[model samples]
Structures are given as C-alpha cells and as structure tokens.
Target: MTSEELNSNTTSKTQDNALGPAVQLTDEELSANPEYVLEQTLSTILSRPVVCDEESDVDQETNALFTDDDDGDNADGNQRTSNENNRHKQSDSPQTGLSRWKPTLHKPAPSIYILCSLMSVKVLAENLVLGVITDLTLAKIQKYYEDNERQSQKEFAKFQSVTSVIQGLLGISLCSKYGHLSDNHGRVFVLQICGLLTILGSLANLYIYKDSTTYEFYSFVFFYCIEALNAGQMSMVAVGNSYVSDIVSEDNRMVCISFFMSIMYATIGIGPLVGSFLVKIFKGNSFNTLYVALFLNVSYTLGVEFFLSESRTVNERRESQSQYHNEVLRKNLRKEQAIFSKESSKWSKVYHLLKMDTLIDLFKPLKTLWVPKTALGSLVPRINVLILVIIEMFVGGSVEGSVQAIVTYSMFKYSWSSVEIGYYYSISGVGRALVLLLAVPQLISFLKRRNYVALPDSIDRIDMIHLYLFLIFVITAFASMIVYETNDIGSYLNSLFISLSAFALPTVQNGVIKYASKKSIGQVFAAMAVLRHLMSLIAPPLYLQVYAATAKTFPTLFLYIPIILSALSLVLLQFVKIVKDHDMLRRQSEASFNNFDEHINNYSVNTKPNTSFDIANNLKNGKSNLQSNSIPIETTPLFKKSHFTGKDNIRNSYKSLRNSFVNSNTPSSKNSSLDKLKAQNFSAFNVPPSV
Candidate 1:
C-alpha cells in the first residue's frame, strides 16, 4: 500500500526466491527420485526454469497447463520451453569448471542508506557552491561574453587551472593516507574526520573571500588546504563506497552501490537548482549564496558526527564477530605483550607506539596474495589487472572531463550564460541519475533472469562494463563533434551519454571494490580516490588545451579524444584475464591452520615425556642429579609428577613448552608460523627416541 510496505514485500519475495526446492519436495518423493529432486533444487536455487526432455516423466503441475491441448501439441510446447531452460543452466554445475567472480560482503543493516543520503546532500551542496564560486568572483567570467580575446579571461583561466593542478597535487599524499588509515583505524572515523575538515576548510574560504571583490591566489589557499586535509570530493566518494562495501552482500552489492551513487547524483542534481533558487531570491547576489552553502556544510558535519553509526566499531578483521570476540582478541593481545616483552610496562603508550613496527606496513596488503580466502588474488591475476583498472578509471575521467569543456563550449559556441550552463548540468545529472537508479538495475535483472552470460569464475556481474564503456565513449565523442551543429537535439543526446555513463561507471568501479575484503575496502577505495584525483589533475588541463587549440577551426573533432581514450581502455580491459578462484586457497589455509592448531593443542595434552626410566635409574644410582636440592624441577600442570633427570634441565623444558603453546595462539604470525613453531618449539619438547 505504501512505499515502506512495498519495500517490505519486495524484500520478502527476494528472500523467498533464495530458498531451494526442499520446501516443496517431500522426503519420500525426494528419496524415490533423488536426481529429480537435485535438479529441481538446482533450478530453484539458480533461478532457472525447469529443463527436461519431452520423453521424461512430467510432474502433474507441469502437465496441468497442457491438458487443454492435444497430448502431442502439449509435449511439443513443453519441449521448446525445456530446451531454452537447458541452455540457461549450462554453467550451473561446478564440473563446468567456471562461474563469474562476485565476492560476498557481510550484509549490513538498513540505516547505512540514510547515512549515504545525508552525505550525498552535503556533497551536492558543496560541489554546487564550488562550481559557482569562480563564476561569481572571477572578472574574466563576465568578460568572456563581452570580449573575444580578453586578457582578464586568460588570467582567470590561468588562475583556475593552476589552482586545480595544485589542489590535485595536495590531495594525492593525503588521499592515500586516508585509505591506509581507514583500513587500520575504521572507515566511519576517517569519514567523519574528513567531513569535519572539509567544513572547516569551506568555512575558512568563506571567511577569506565572502566580501572580496575579486578572486586571488591567496583565496585559493583555503581550497588547497581543504584538498590536502580532507581529500576533497574523492574522500567522500571513496570512504562512502567503503561504507557500502562493509554492509551489502555480493548479490545485492552492484545494485546497492549504483543506488547509492544514484542518490549522490540525484542530490547533486538538486544542489545547483537550490543554489540557483537562492540566487534568484537574493536578486543574483552570489556572495551570500557561498556563506549559505558553508552554513549547510557545517550542519552536515555535525550530523555525521552525531548520527552515523560506525560500520566497523571493532577491529575490521574481526568485524563479523560478536563483541565478545573483540574483547577476547584484546585480552589475548594484552597477554601476549605481557609475556613477550617482560621489561615493557603495560601502560607505556610510547613503548607501544614504538613497537607498532610499521617498516613494511605500506606493502602489508601485498601479503594478501598469500591468503587464499580473499578476492584480492583473483582481482589481480597479474600486474596488468591493476594497470587495466587504473587505465579504465583514467579514460573514464577523461571522458567525464568533457562536461566541463562543454560548459566553455556553450559559452564560445552557443553564447549560453552561466545560468543556462547550471540548468544544463542539472538536466544531465537527472538523466544520469535515472539511468543508474532505474535503467541499469532493470538491465541487470533482465540478464540475470535469462542467465545467458557465462560469467567467469573470477569476474563479476557487470564484467561487460568496460566493453560497453568503449561504445558509450565513442558515441559520446561522435555526438560531441556534431553538438555545435545539432543544437538542442545534440545537447539532449550528450546528456543521454552522460546519463549512460552514470549507469556504467559504478559497474566498472564496483569490479575493483568487490574484490576487496571488508577490512581492505577502505584501502581499495582510497586507491581509487587517488587514481581519480590524479586523473583530475591531467584531464581538465588536457581537455582545455585541446579545446583552446581546436575551438575555431574544428570544434566538432574534439569528441575524438575521449573516443581514443575509451578505445585504449577497452583494449586494456581485454588483456585483463579473470584468474582461477583463490577463495579455495583461503579455505585451505584456514583448514591447515585449524589442523595445525588442533595438532599442537592435542600434542600439549596427549604428550607424556617418559622421564620415568631416567628418574628411576637416577634414584637407583644414589640420587645423581634428581636428589640435588639446587636443581629445582618446575612442574608441568598436566605432568605434575614427572621429574627432571640427566642434567636437571626440567625448568628449560617447561619454559620452552610454555613459550611454544602461548606464542602459537597469538593473533599475528610470521610466514611459516606453524612450521616454525613445529620446528623450534615442538622439537624442544619431543624428547629424543634414545632417551
């Protein structure tokens, strides 16, 4: 009846769909026809229609529909339907040796989307205000309409370009740091910090330039500081994606992320409209609009600080576990510190900081290649995978860069005003948002139902994204060439292209984030953010240069640049092969560790050192070393009566065995931890056969 009620029913339907045919099949019937039952279960679970040969026995429900027709005609109808179903289930069995890559995530609660909505509103307002700032303050912004070759226009352009580059440079180091920090600390904490800093920087900018008559390099300093401290828009997008990754399952992840991104675009679409409304209300006073945006940003930060529930309150590695496990880990870690570092004080913060051992921390993620449970191994089959992903983002960035160039083209080619550009941007945003929110999910669902695509074991649901990207870019590029001649129709088509991009871009980015574990999502997103910022540094300058060079002579051919970049991205995507499943490797590692731990634990309990013969002989030989009061034999809790003999080394034996058992259970480990424990500790305890 209501949207909430509709959502509830829809969620129930999906949940119901996930169950296999066991609910419908009787135990006696299943036992009598096990193969048929298996087939039915597989069909239900895989969401494929029933597939059976015409000669095969039909269940009564299936035969009922065809009862109205002749038996021969009914059989023919059934045959066609069954054949199509059969075609869909070719890769359903594991013996087929392949299925697509889609890494599962821990399902988070519903409150996260509310958080996304808040952040999106903040971003929409923030970016909209930033976009209008240069328009409001730069002297050349108005002069572009009056003078064809204005000196003031060139100076303003130079200033904007230089500052954009500087801001990008400033974001690079800090963006990477945020990723690593979020991974180590927690995503929500870093996100809140980023939000706070962004508000501070924006407020500082307002303080500097609120009443200023003109833009200056000094005014740009506040913006640069924002980029350096907060990582600008990249921080929000990166950490926001990380937050989503923490909660959504693999099945729903792509759609959920798209939905999240759509909300961002949707809100961003609303931002300029709101700003434009404000401008009209104040009779086009852009100065007051900037301060209003600053005040709104401050409110968003306070909202984030108070309202956002942390996605990872415990250590991210143990986020899936209950609070009890988190306490257990902390307790174990404390015990380990107390035992290992005898001289170190328990409360020594300086000593703990010194002991963090960050020498190889930057390269710590690379160690994940050895962990088979994770998707990282398959995600990066070769260095080429990383290269392909980065190149794809780079090309995508370059194509998106055309939007800004188009604004300038609207000024130069169509003589459109800033207000018109704002309107055009809003329209494009809506188109993009619609495609992401409505169209893309429908497409995925349509394909998912048919099950026609043979997704590789290491690839994801939308692996075709890069291939489609090549087409989208080429189309957009071709459209851009004729946009000047085509007028309104051309502009609408270009907006459509941007909308198609909104639908497609998240799929490509999802491929990268999907491979990362919940713990590493922040780091992966951070890498993406850094790449995006790096691309931002390159794309804008390059696009402007190309536009400036070709504006009068052949503005139509300007679309070819993005086409070439997209073509290169497609080529890069082709070389990136999906690797074999590495999750099995992780499972095997877990099994081995479990086995090794069990064996050691059993050995500690079951081992009985036969010092009895040696002790009896020592006593028989008139208390050689056993009767020596100086040689105190410390007791093993399990082997209390067991005594030292020969050289009175029982204390050494107990200490080594205690060290072995205690150290093995510590959370972190060196390479070959089990093997080293076996060799060093087990050997010390496993008494010589000669004895």
Candidate 2:
C-alpha cells in the first residue's frame, strides 16, 4: 500500500475511535492522503511526536481510498504551501538574522578596576584623617579654655555644644554639594581633587596652629573650613561608589558594593583608635599628627591619578564616529536618492536627547517620600533608596553625636587629658577597623548570598538588615546610657558599650548606603548626603534639647534621643517590607521580558529557507542545477497549527500556579517557576487516556 493509502486508513480508524463514527466527506478523505495532506487532521490535533522524512510511508491502499477529491483540493493546497513559503522567506531575511547581534555584556577595562580599588583606600584614609583632626583640635581647644579659666563650666559646656552644632551644619552643606558634583564629573577626578584639598586643608591648619598663640576669628573660620572639607571627603567615597555601579553588572553589583562599604566602615572604626594611640606616642602635641593625615591624603590622590584610568568614554566621540560611518555608507548605497535639504540640526537632536524636562522630573525624589515605580512596575529599587536614607539618618547621626559626646564626656567627667581621649578613640578605631577589614565584609557577603538565594526578588534586603543592625546598636547604646545615668553600671562597661556601638553604627550606615547606591551610584549618594545632612541638622538640637530636659534628674539626658530615634527606626522598618515586595515583582517582570526578548532574538537568527524541496525535485528529474556543496536544509514539520483553544486557559492556570508557588516559597522564589512548570506538565501528561 502507498503512504497516502496507509495514512487514510490510520486517520479513519483514529477518527472512528475519537469521534465514535466517520462520515464519507470527500474533503476529509483527500486530507487523509499521507503524501499530499501529511496526516493534516491528526498532526493538527496531536501536535507532538512529529514524523520526519526517514519515517516509513503509508500503505498504497489507504492512498487509493482517499484519492476521490484530490484533484479539486490540489490548487488550494499549492496556494497554502506558496503562502507558507513566502512567510518562511520573510522570516529568513537578513533583517531577521541581524537581530542576533544584540548588546552583549561588556566588562570595564582593568584601569577602572584599579581606580575602584584606590577609591576604597581613599575612603579609609579620609576617615582616618577626620578622626585624627577632630580628636586633636577638640583636645587643644578644651585645654586652652581650661588654662584661661575665662568662662564658667556651664558656659564652656554650652559653647562647646554650639561649636558642634556649627560644625555639623557646615559638614552637611559641604558633603551635600560635593556629592552632587561627583555625580556630574567623573568619580575619580572629583575624588582626587577632594583628596588634595583635604591634604592642603590639614597642612594649613597644622602650620597656622604651630605659630599662633592668640585665639582669633580666623582660627574658628580656618577650623570650620577644615571641618567642612573633612565632611566633603565623603563625596569622594560617593564618587567611588558611582564608579562601581557604572562598571559592575546588576547581578554582581551588590556583592562588590557591599564589600567596598564594609571596608569603608571598618576603617572608620579603626581610624580613631589608631589616632588615639598615635596621640599618646606623640605626647600632647596632637597638632603634629596632622602631618601623617596630610601625607596619607596626598599619597592617595597621587595614586589615583597615576594608577586609575577614566571609566566614562565621551558619548560625543562614539556618536560622531557612528554617524559619520553610517552616513557615508548610506550615501554610497543610495547615490540616486535625494538627501533632505533640512535635516534636523545636531544641536536640536542633542537637546531632545538631553530631555531637560525628564531630568527635572527626577528631582521629585528629593522633595517627596513617594518613590516612582520603574518600567517593570516594581517599587523595590525606590524602597531600597528610602530604607537607605532612614538607616543612614538615624545611625549616622547617632555615631557622629556619640563620638563628639565621648570626647566631651571624657574631658569633663573623667578629667582625661588630650592624650587619654586620643588613646580611647584610637582603641575604638581599632575595633572599627577590625569590623571593616574582617567581620563586616564577611557579614555583607553572607547577607548578599542570603538576599540572592532567599529574597532574590527584593532589592532592599540589605537595607532592611542594616535597619535591624542599627536598631540593635541604638537599643544597646541607650541601655548603656541609662545604666550610666542611674549609677548602676561601671564606667568601664559604659565605655565599652559606647565604643562598641560607635564601631557597629557605621557598619549599618555604610551597608545600607552602599546597597542603595549600587544601581545609580551618584543619585543614591546625593540623596543619602541630603538625608545625612538633615539628620545632622536635627541631631545637635535634638540632643541638646533632650539633654536640657532630662539634666535635672539624669546626667545622661542624651540617652533618651536614641531610644526615640530607635523606636522611629523600627517604624521605618515596616516600609522596608512594602518596598521589598514591590521590588521582587518588578524583577520577575523584567526577567520575563528579558527571556522573551532573548527567545525572539534566537528564533530570528536561526530561521532559514528550506531549499530541500527544490533539491529533491532536481534529484527526481535528474537535473544538475543544484550546488553539490550546499548545506543541507533542516526539515521542519509540514503542519504548524495546533489546538490553541486552551492557551489562554493554560496561561491563566500557570499564573495561578506560579502565585501559589511564590507564596509558598516565601524568602526564596527563584526555583518556583521551574518546579511549578515541571509539576504541571508531568501531571498533565501522566493522566490516563480518556475512555
């Protein structure tokens, strides 16, 4: 029997079994011919286990039985085949093949890597310099006030508090402005400049103090500027962070940023402790220690310029070359085509590209608490920013306040000399350094892994973790303060807890800031600077007010502010949940789009014309027109149509299944889709044949 005849008999039997009866329709019988119709009905229904060319042909008797209406349907079948061939030709066009060359992931040059590393070093150096300067200057100023005995103790105390307030305000302003500047210019360039300024400022302060005996207005201005410069050093760190974001992929960014931040905070902790010990070695001449800080800053600046290469390539250069080549090629190809006399000017194109209106729209984040959802409809990225701001504000403010308070408290209460305060701060610095160098980096790495595995969808887990850590430090610090106030805890324990809190505070603050800054380095840093400054503005007054209010009964009135702040921080933690949920959904949507785009790209690239039909005809006719070396065409199934009836239902069902899976997965939903798809398909195919 022929292939057509065998196909007809099989179709008749299959139809008989499925529908319980078979009618004698000529069109149906013709479609049953295996050679002409290719088992159209069954191929359409089953849509799987497709037969290739090598498969055995249907029996001849089946073909004869289905030959009644073959002549009439022949023209229609040929037309359908021609239309499909046309579509296949279009699908195989060069335009479709061009889709293969999509934007692939590119790694930044080695110089960028070197610059990033140097930036990390600069962060450490600046923190160290700040610690050394603050400790030394405060010590000298306090001693001078004491020697003169010009003012009463209460007045001196108030004066010192006022100095702190002024310093905090100035620090906030400088840091915020520089942070914005670093966003505009390259991070390395701005950082190098900042480092140089720090070195100069430190040296100038050192030189002026050595010869000056009288306290003058210039002295305060000089130191104030120095303090401002010190605060502005943070901008350098911000610039480094922005660079990291620019270089790293989204998948690997968190780990790299977390490592950088951990190192930065670790240095913050160690700087003071090292400075204090150094102060003891230098005796009472704390001013001399400025030289060492100056050296570190200058060295870091020089190292950056010499070793670090610029990460940002000029867009104008790339655009000019691309446009030149494209225009030349186009002109060559279409010599007869008239060029437009008035094409839009380049400046106009640039103006439109700049989108000043859209740029202005971004400013809303600064003024408002509400975060805009990204294209993927996820709020996680924005929530991550908010959480960072909150975490930095409370924790950053506390650390700055506590550090100042410790210096003042040691001087007034313990009667420790400049050397003693420096020594204590240096020890605290060592603890901080250890955390940054060893403990914090490891902790950040672990947290990041947990974030990827457990909360892969959420971008703000790191921020949330930071908030929790900040709360722990705040509560512990407040409790220690309370104990000290009530005379229930020893001075040793109080000092130990205070030092520990200071060390831990920066870790939490840096972690959150680094995490948020991972995506848009400059913007996040700018926003953080604004928040930190706001905190600085509030912290001094709030501390003073609380101190004044509780001073009559409790000597440690500063303790209450932390408790209030800590409680407020906990409230902020609730928002983290909202942000995280939004981010996860956004990521899933983005991943889905990316996968779809990739599939389309792959399909477009791989599609080609099937020349096998022409070759087969040539072979049958004994013609020699075909090329002997031509690549073999891959055979595709003749019938492409399948039962699309349940597609929408399947999608809906799958969506529902995915939702359940996500809910059950909780912290980690990474594998839920694969598991759900497999389970659904397995159960679907495993069902027994219908009776």
Give Cα-based local distance difference scores for all models: 0.54, 0.47
lDDT (Cα, tens digit) per residue for candidate 1, span 413-470: 7788866776777777887788778977887788777773424224443556534654
Candidate 2 lDDT over 568-622, as tens digits, reads 8778767655333433344331332222222212221122223434322322221
| TM-score list, all predictions | 0.62, 0.53
Error of 1 at 358 (Å): 14
Stretches of candidate 1 off by over 4 Å are: 1-110, 139-151, 212-216, 223-228, 317-380, 452-457, 465-488, 551-554, 578-670, 683-691
What would you estimate as the lDDT of candidate 2? 0.47
Scored by TM-score, the top model is 1
- Backbone Cα, N, C clashes tallied per candidate: 7, 24
Instruction: Estimate the Cα RMSD of every predicted model relative to the unseen true structure.
Output: 21.6, 18.6
